[model samples]
Target chain A: MAVKAVKRIDLSLAPLVENTRRVIKGLKLHTICDSGNCPNMHECYGSSTATFMIMGNVCTRDCRFCSVKNGKPQEPDKTEPGRVAEAVVKLNLKHVVITSVTRDDQDDKGVFNFVETIREIRKRSPGTVIEVLVPDFGGIEELIETLVRARPDIIGHNLETIARLYYLLKPDSSYFRSLSVLHMVKEFNPDICTKSGIMVGLGENEDDVIEVMRDIKEIKCDIFTIGQYLRPTGEQFEVKRHVDEDEFQRYEVVAGSMKYAYVIAGTFVRSSYRAGEYYQKYQESRKG
Target chain B: MKEIILPELGEDIKEATVSFWHHKEGDEVKAEEDIVEFYTDKANFSVKAQASGILKAISVKEGEKASVGQVIGEIEER
Candidate 1:
């Protein structure tokens, strides 16, 4: 029998999808969902949820697997913080995920934008939850501290792939540096949830994936998500294999056993997928 | 006469509720202009006029449900 395949849901005709696109366009905001060509774009947009990309769409580093544009970026927009907050209110998002392209050229590596955006959201929408999927900030402790000081509800940094393949996939980034980014967040403030994710199907074996999980566990990271890597375009890295549902289930079982605060493993799962629900669950767990 | 049929909304969406009509019956509508908005459990979608005409009838009232391809209204083409 053939293995069951997980596929992206088709939502092109959804009216709210068009409306959300219009809002983002009108507000002049960029979203990782659009910039990265995320598979869940239409579904997320239809439901009025989007991962806002700050700083600018251009990135400083070229990652082989990423779809975001890599080039010298323009100066960060001063009005972006307020506009993102306004978009949160307009979309009526209870939880919003903010991410940005890697800006290695900047002195602070765009930490200021992250901090200001968090402050703006808190000022405008006190009750709304903020989650930031951040770049490594070059693993600088003070830059990390500046963002931690802003107090986003959750901070996520994707490991992107296993350690051995890290150099091949993310040539400009360091695997150890990415690990320290998650480790430092816990060190700075354990109260704020720390998250990291990895992509599979880029020619890694199960043992390699397990070793990465153990590494994450060793750092005491709180949340873990794993998903199959779908090739975005011919220009980017090609998928080594199509991981089936059974493998995803086995990974889920393995991750669950590792004592993460929460773990989601599947073909369709992304680090920021249904993040609001996970935050709610994390909050509930805290109460209990 | 052009029948205003609800277009296929793609994947698992079977029906929608008429949320609002941008124009009332007997109002002149331009081709490609949105005339009605329908909402499902997931999203609110706007339907556009196929051609410039006068809206002659509304088979589905506001807050009423409609199925895919159902004629919810009519337009008398100029």
Candidate 2:
């Protein structure tokens, strides 16, 4: 019974913006910021913010620790939702996150290119606030109710680690099919804020991280991102211990006492890192 | 010199493949160690030496591909 030594937080690196490289070269679109070597991609593209990795850049499910790129998958650029809505209207971003790569070789697994890139980034970034880090189509509740009927205010899905290292770091993923795709994304829209994330060092156990925060708060998943898994490649998956900074502030006080309306546990949290400062502090805590 | 580049390891990783080189053009390495090894589409990676000297020029070759932030080598500061 000897296991409690987590303390490693040396985060302070952020600088890289030329309008985030001119919105990925004027939306020829493709990001996970240079394919996932994301140590918060230089503090979220040095604060101009960027997270768009739309349906391409190849990946038909290989997930070891992900550095995106699987093979033979290049056909779904049907104008990549109007070139990611003209690079989210030329990077005047207010909050956007779109993600992709697990096309399982098509057949709806790409969810119609994530519902036409969230309906052309909500008709050309009008008010911009879309977020989508998806991929659980294998749990297909009609493709997670068609990306919650193309209504993306936020709908992330990443049970990245835990549940006994989900078969050694996402072995074709399925920790109860990613908690049934975040319990069917709040049974398909309960205000649509069903986020999910986890990646604490690799040898999970604090009761498997409080049973994955009680299975993502019984699948209500409002939002939660606990980072630090840093192993990006050595054949992928081997940072068996580095959960520090006071255990990410005790996992944000145990995911805010299990009532996660927002919980970004540290070590440089990712999953759209400072996602517009946590969606503006979750819209001022739901307008108080 | 500051030119270690080569990162962007995820979300549909468009190019990496190189896989092997842990230091050459004069060696030295350190800041984050593991100098070179790549292959992405979700695994097999190792580019760490963000800063800590000597390995001056490698310019993508092990099996080629590179791309992402692209530079592949050049450190020189030992």
* Leading candidate by TM-score: 1
What ranges in model 2 sit over 4 Å off? A1-19, A24-37, A40-49, A52-87, A91-95, A98-121, A125-129, A132-188, A191-193, A199-210, A213-217, A222-240, A243-269, A273-288, B1-78
A129, model 1: CA deviation in Å? Answer: 0.8
Q: For candidate 2, what is the DockQ-based docking class?
A: incorrect
Worst 10 residues of 2 chain B by lDDT: B38-47
What tens-digit string does per-residue lDDT give for candidate 2 at B18-62?
867866788788777667776654335455676787887998878
In the range A112-139, model 1's lDDT, one tens digit per residue, is 9999999999999999989999999999
lDDT of 2: 0.73
**Please, what are the lDDT tens digits per residue for candidate 2 over residues A1-288?**
223222211121213454566668766778876666664454466556778888777887777777676777878878888887787777678888888878877788888788887888788777988888988888879888988988888888888887766676677778898788878878878888878888777787666877777878887787778877766556676666766677778877876666664777776677678887887886787677
Scoring the B chain of model 1 against the true B chain gives a TM-score of 0.92
What TM-score does model 1 achieve against the real structure? 0.77
